[model samples]
Target: MTVRVRLFAGAAEAIGQDEVTLADVTTLGDLVARLVADFGSGVAPVLDRCSFLVDGVRAADAETRVTGTVDVLPPFAGG
Candidate 1:
């Protein structure tokens, strides 16, 4: 299944886009690896502090299965 990922905050800047698609079911960590590879190590530090949401609800684990639309949310610095 293809999953859509929406990037937010520093992630969006690192990725240079707000959205992307993955071709199969992947863990959040796997997806992050891909993103870091594609974008650059500049995203790595931010990614370490990032969180994920699968279709809106927070994903508590990096091993969490992501099969559908997901959001890659980097740490936000503002109120």
Candidate 2:
């Protein structure tokens, strides 16, 4: 399967881009592995602090199956 990823905040900075298209990423865990493998160490920490929305639905766990668009959102601060 192919998944389109949208990165925000630190995730985008770490990966050096806000959007990416990945193949064979069947689950959230698989997507993380692929990002770490493709982008190296910089992305891991950012990913760790992030939450994911798969097709606008919150992903409950790394094992959550992913398709369509996956949004990577780092912790946001506002007042």
Top candidate by lDDT: 2
lDDT per prediction? 0.83, 0.96
Q: Could you tell me the TM-score of candidate 2?
A: 0.97
Q: For model 2, which pairs clash?
A: none
Q: Summarize candidate 1's per-residue lDDT along 1-79 as a digit string, tens digits.
A: 6889998877888788989987755888788887778788888888788888987889988798787888888766778
The reply for model 2, stretches above 4 Å from the true place, is none
The TM-scores of all predictions, comma-separated, are 0.85, 0.97
lDDT value for model 2: 0.96
